[model samples]
Target: MNRNDRAIVALVTLGHAMVHTYELSIPIFVSVWLASPAFSADAATLGVVATVGYGLFGLGALPGGVLADTVGSKRLIVGCLLGMAGSFALLSVASSVWVVAVALCLWGIAASVYHPSGLSLISRGVEARGSAFAYHGMAGNVGIALGPLAATLLLLVLDWRGVALVLTLPAVLGAVLALRFDVDERAAVADGGTETDGGEEAGDSKADAVSSWPEFVAGSKRLFAGGFVVIFAIVVCSGLYYRGVLTFLPEILGDFPSLQPVEFGGRSLEPGRYVYAGMLMVGVVGQYVGGRLTDRVQPSRVLPFAFGLLGLLALAFVPLSSVGLLPVLALCGVLGVALFVVQPLYQAAVAEHTPAGTRGLSYGYTYLGVFGVGALGGTLAGGLLTYADVGVLFVVLAGIGLAGALASFVLGRRA
Candidate 1:
């Protein structure tokens, strides 16, 4: 990576970490909500509520993508950081579930623009694209891992409201950092060719960049008409599997008898939260490995294998959780790795399969599949957990993982 690539990575890395930090913190808050007498709601009902906000997080990506292309990645990112900070500040003051939902809604819209904008910048700007994706994901995992831990620790000292208020600080710092870093989004585009896999020049792809709504539709149609359709399906499966598994994971981990609450600093703490945080922390290694592999191996070839591992892990997750603490903790660590390793593979796949000009639009729709449609995973988990046993939920999650594996397999064969 050159100095320019390093700077770009620094910017996106900070932004990505802050986003996930806020994101993963929400579930930690959900447990508090469930216990509160102010809002009496079961797991399924809360799940649906969370999905509404989480869905918007994904749903808003279409316009966010277009906005990324039109306005530029840097500007969208700054807005994202500020919007996220404000949303969490709202979360700190919530007296009812409705307010909680509203905060999440604002967060969804704010955070929605990030992947499209940041990823577009990296794909077009960074020379070491694969490495850039790795570093970007690694930083995100740092936030993912730290957010829950931070929130949980804060809970011992302060109320959940305090934790929420404290969570807003990092993004303010991220926003300041965003203003400091600058890079050429077109750096890689100039060195690489103008042609897409579909044989259109880069300029041709962007001819309609700022055009009418129908052009956006036509562009999407063209994008889907090619092998990107499979890419689309693969990401959907990825989102489903990822979101389903993660949305209720802390709660799920609590079901394990072996992972009971612990006393630390004279405060009773849930070890499950720590376990969840540890799981996410290991994803840093997964991100690094997955990103580096894409630089060397064809991401398409690895995609199926990666998804297959996730499937197998999900199937094993329930059974392993019942055995003992050590085993389940170990499983969580492995599951974390298998879970996050798939991210960079698909991200690289998107970059390789799509054109340079519409990178923002491509990643926009990409996350829409991931967060938007994928937000359903939360509801699925919530419903399953509400009505059925952990075994049933694992069976359903296993099916989603296997489905992702199958879709990835098909995409790999085509590649």
Candidate 2:
């Protein structure tokens, strides 16, 4: 990797990390707020608020993709950071439910831009695509692990408001760093310099021209015609499974007698947060392994195994939890690994299947399915838990995973 590649990787990696940090940090705040008398909200009402935020995260991806192409990926990324920081700042000062909703909405909109912009930058700008994707995914896993850990630790020291304010620092720092780094692939393509390694030219000179809604639609149409629609469907199913199982994972883990108090650093910590964060930490290995595999094996081949196993594990999670602590912990670790392993596989698959011309828009729709439409999983989980047992919830999640597995299998054949 050259200096430019290092800068791009650093920028995108930081961007991906911060996005997950802010996202996962919200649940911590929700837990805190639910317990506080200030909110006076029931579980169901708070769940709805969280759902709104999650839904908006998904909803904002389309326009975010368009902006990535229009305004430039770097600019959009910087905007995402600044926007997330501002959202956190707002959240820090939030006094009512409505204010929290507004802040979360802002966060959703801000965070929506990152996938399209950062992934587009990597797919187009970086020389080592697979390695970059691996490192990027690994960075995301790091954030996934650290976000809850940091939030939980911060909660012990200060109020949730203070935590939100402190969390804003990272996005601000990331934004400043992003501004200093100049590795915009779109700009490079416009300069007629080949930025990608032996890859296709970024796009035609006409692609450098400004894109409007009509052109954006036409590009999406082309992507669909090129068989990316199948990938989109696969990602949607993956999203549903991912969001459903994880939405209440910490609470689910809290049900385990063995996980009642996870000890660390001579302190008995909250089992739910540590267990959840530990499982997410295991995903770092999965991210790195899955990422490296994409450079060697066919990404399609990697997809079915990971997705299918995730389905089986989702079904096994409840039964395993009833058995003993070690088995349940093992299952959670495997679940985390399987969950993240498919990410890089499909991310690489998306890059492989789409043309450079409309890659950002393709990623936009991809994330729309992954995050936007996927946000429904939280609501789905809430409804199921309200009416049914945990077994039923896992069964539904298993079904979603199996559906995704089937989609990936079909995608493999089609691709």
Best-fitting candidate, scored by lDDT: 1
Cα lDDT for residue 169, candidate 2: 96
Model 2 agreement with the true structure over 45-141: per-residue lDDT tens digits: 6666777887788778878877776677888889999999999999999999999989998999899999988888887777778899999999999
How high is the lDDT of residue 264 in model 1?
75
lDDT of 2 at 127: 73
lDDT of 1 by residue, 93-173 (tens): 999888999999999999999999999888877878888999999999999999999998899889998999988888998
- TM-score on alpha carbons, each prediction: 0.96, 0.93
Which parts of model 1 have CA positions greater than 4 angstroms off?
A: 191-210
Candidate with maximal TM-score? 1
Error of 2 at 120 (Å): 0.5
Against the reference, the lDDT scores of all candidates come to: 0.85, 0.82
lDDT of 2 at 266: 67
